[model samples]
Target: MGTKSAFNWVTLWASLLFVVILGFSRLSYGMFLPGIQRVLGGSYGQLGILGTVNFIGYLVGTLCLSPLISRFTDRKQVINRMTCLLLGLTLIGSALSDDFTQLGLWRFIIGLLSAIATVLVLSIAMDAVRPAERGVASGLIWLGGSAGILVTGLFAPFTIDPLHLQGWRYAWVTMGVFGVIAAIGFDFATRKRGVVTIPSQTESKLRDRESENVYRLLLNPKRFLFLITSYFFFGAGYIVYFTFLIPYLVSKGTPSLYTGLIWSGIGFAGLFNGWIGGKAIDRWPSGYTLALGLTLGTIGVFGITTNNLLFTVLGASLIGLVSFITPPLMTTALLRRDIPDHLYAVCLSIATAFFASGQIIGPIIGGIVVERHGLQFGVASSAIFMAIAALLAGLYGLQQRKLEVRDLPISS
Candidate 1:
């Protein structure tokens, strides 16, 4: 195949891999959790802890695996290796289950592998597309994940054996099989593409300098401190709704059919939102767009707390639409704002880690609020954090505008 055709082919398969990875590999566990717990005879506390463990692995993987990418010579090699390892981990998550302890270990490993797959796949997508289209490309790539969730939703009814409802081992195994297929497809698609090559050997002195630079900027108090703080708030709010939306609907006496419908709404909204987000990033300043997205997210969470299903679905859809819209642009914006290409992975990995950390805290905090106060309080509290993110973003926007003005004066 010609270079252009090869690139397109690679994009198609990588997106597919990401969708499968997002859906079956990472997100499906929530759907399977209740079933697993019933079979394992574990308390809710145990189940929640298992989730926390998996998230910790995710956080750690994002933090630790980034440097390895910089050290590798071939992007394709990184993608294939991570895909295979994640697939293997998925199989383990499916097949090995004597007890909760074993299951948690497997789940944690699966999460760790998935973080690697997600970042690599995203990097592949971003690099494959044109600069102007980066946001749209990234958005579409993530929507692959949304598609995966849709697949999970459609498959759950069929794969879940009601007789063996407690352990739904069959469902998990099927998911693992799907992940392997995705990995194989990903490997085949990228095998022939011409792409950017990372050099494996940085001279000893250069490696030391790069390490110092990466840590200096990553840990820079003056640079990303505010961005990190804002994202921390974004993490706390986004996770509460993303993780608990279905359960919250069920608790409110909504029918299962409606709950399913709401999930579909989220997926559908993401499809459109992804396109809009991509376009918006190219046409407008990304920080402004991101602030707007966070504002919408706040509204959505607050609506869910009102006990109105119409408002709740609308709010949930807004959250799904806006949050997914922000990531690609957010990444792109961070890159454009002066972070170098070499340190891009480092910055992103750190951002993801902070995001995961917030996610880690979100569930625990939300759970406490739900148990002690009520579901409304839990959801409402999340809105508060999103509001804070918006406020911080607005401040960032002001700072950026001032910097732009100062630079323009110099040019004049």
Candidate 2:
């Protein structure tokens, strides 16, 4: 294979490993949510808490991974895959959860393990690729998430029974088993002969310090506030759709089978959206691209309101397509805003934390709205957040233009 083809295959394999990491660890919870909730007798608010705990696990992992991995950088590769291994096992163990409390704990473990895998995969895998290819690597890894959703969407309908819950447990066990096998396969394929000392804790510390300093230098209250707040709302808006849409559909008396189809459509749309979004980041002005994405996402969120099946499917497609698109664009915008290479890692990590925090709260608020207003209305409420994110992006773009115009030299 040529260089391009070789890298494509390498990235493809990386993405597939990510699929196992997310599928077994995280997505399975959502896919199995409806049945498991009924089986375990979880209330809507409690289930919302369950989702919140999952992101909290992710948030904790995101915060700790840098420091933890910095302590063992040469073994970072080992650390990453081991996380996958443990993640698979934990997910398998979750099938045994006997109640909502147990299920919540299990999902939290799943979230933690997946977060470690995610931080490792995104950081390590990008390091392995060319600088120009980093965006593509991020897209592929995210596409791996879409694949996870697609697999769950295609599989869950067949595995579920409106009257039976055993299928839910069985599905969890099956994902765990396959995840273990995939994890082992990856380990064998990437097995190496010798250790590289440069990936050491010392390097990690130096890098961390660089990121910290760069972030501090780049700090500007007005501009960074818009970027960070936009990210925060994105985290808030998207999770509502992801966590509750299926339950909403099912509660409305939509068949379990149709719920799977809707989710699968989301996964399918996301595949193309990731690619298109990455390219848009490369070509367009950062704020404008983000503005467009959030606006499209706002339209997608509103699409959830109507009861028509056709409209539901169309809405699901739009929501999926844009769900993961805007975040990457935000990343592009950050990097393009004159950040240096060393600072990119830390800045991105901080921004991602904002997103994760939004995720932590999104489900709670969404759950409250759903509990009080009904599922459709709960989903509709998310649009308000997306609209705000779009507005923030617009303002940021305008701020940049004014700064640019003011920088022009005076005429003699």
Candidate 3:
């Protein structure tokens, strides 16, 4: 197959991997919280703890990944497939859970495996395409999460029955089955054609030099710190909206049907994120692109606080369009540009650890705020976090520009 054709084929299956790992395994949890609560009998605070535990597991997973990959460098594909398999089995375990504790344990395992699968899949997908196309390729891979969201939104309503209280279990089982299918497909598709590698001796020497000083190189850049900090805030901020939006709407007396439509609308808007966000990153500076996305996300979160149905729908749509996956997409693309290819996975793992840390804190803080003040205020907190992230990203952008100018060669 031609290079472009291979890229398309690999990226397609990789995106499907994202759909199962991120979309079904991770994001779908928030959407089913109410049903879980109904059957298990827990306060919002307790349920929120489940989210926190999951992120803690995620954090642990990201931290472990680099070391694991280092030890088993040649078996990266084996690791990926094994993680995918465990993730599916864990979801099945979740479906069979009888209590909050059991469910939380399963969720924790799911988070761990999901984190590994996500980082590996994105790394593979990004490696499949040319340098110039990395932005678009990352966007396409993340777009699978949007696809998962859309499917979950549509499927959630059918599986969650107020009378049954057991309907949500079926959703988990179905997601598990799909996850297994995705794993099988990904293994088959990528078996022959693996990640593109740089075989040049000079490039290998350069990579070796860079790898030795990777930590120093990454730390020396003020912009890298800003980028990761922004990622943390983005993680803390955007998750509140996703975790609470459906529950908040339900509390406001919105019908399940309208809520599903709103949720699906968010997913629908996300369909264009790859095109819009990919083009933005490809053209604009990464810092600027990140800032723009965070700003838009801030506005979207604020719009939800208004609680007007129209505004909420519009807010959800805007978030899905610009912010949902944009921050991480931009972050990864920028890192790929700056870091050596050999160290990309390690660097990404570090960045994702920061992101996971934020996710752990977000749900807990949001839960407290929601319990004390209200869901409106809880939602507003998300906007505040995003606004802070935008400022940091903008500062990073400015710093990057100045560095570029300082390094520019003078014409004789």
- Our tally of clashes for model 3 stands at 0
- Per-candidate alpha-carbon RMSD to the true structure: 3.9, 4.4, 3.2
Candidate 1 lDDT, 1-412, residue by residue in tens: 2224213766667667766666666566655554565577764445656666777877888877666655553454655556565665565465558797888788677767777776666665555566555666666666676666666655444333344564457666766776677777766666666544454454434544565566555444444555666777787776666555654555576654556667666767766766677667667654567788888888888777667778887887887688744654464445434554455555677777776787678777776776777666766788887888887766656655655521332112
Where is model 3 poorest over a 10-residue stretch in terms of lDDT? 403-412
Q: What ranges in model 2 sit over 4 Å off?
A: 1-6, 185-208, 214-219, 222-225, 325-343, 396-412
Clashing pairs in 2: none
Per-residue lDDT tens digits for candidate 2, residues 141-167, read: 667767777888876665555666677
Give each model's clash number.
0, 0, 0
Which lDDT value does model 1 have at 36? 63
Ranking by TM-score: 3, 2, 1
Greater TM-score among 2 and 3 belongs to: 3
Please give each candidate's TM-score.
0.85, 0.87, 0.93
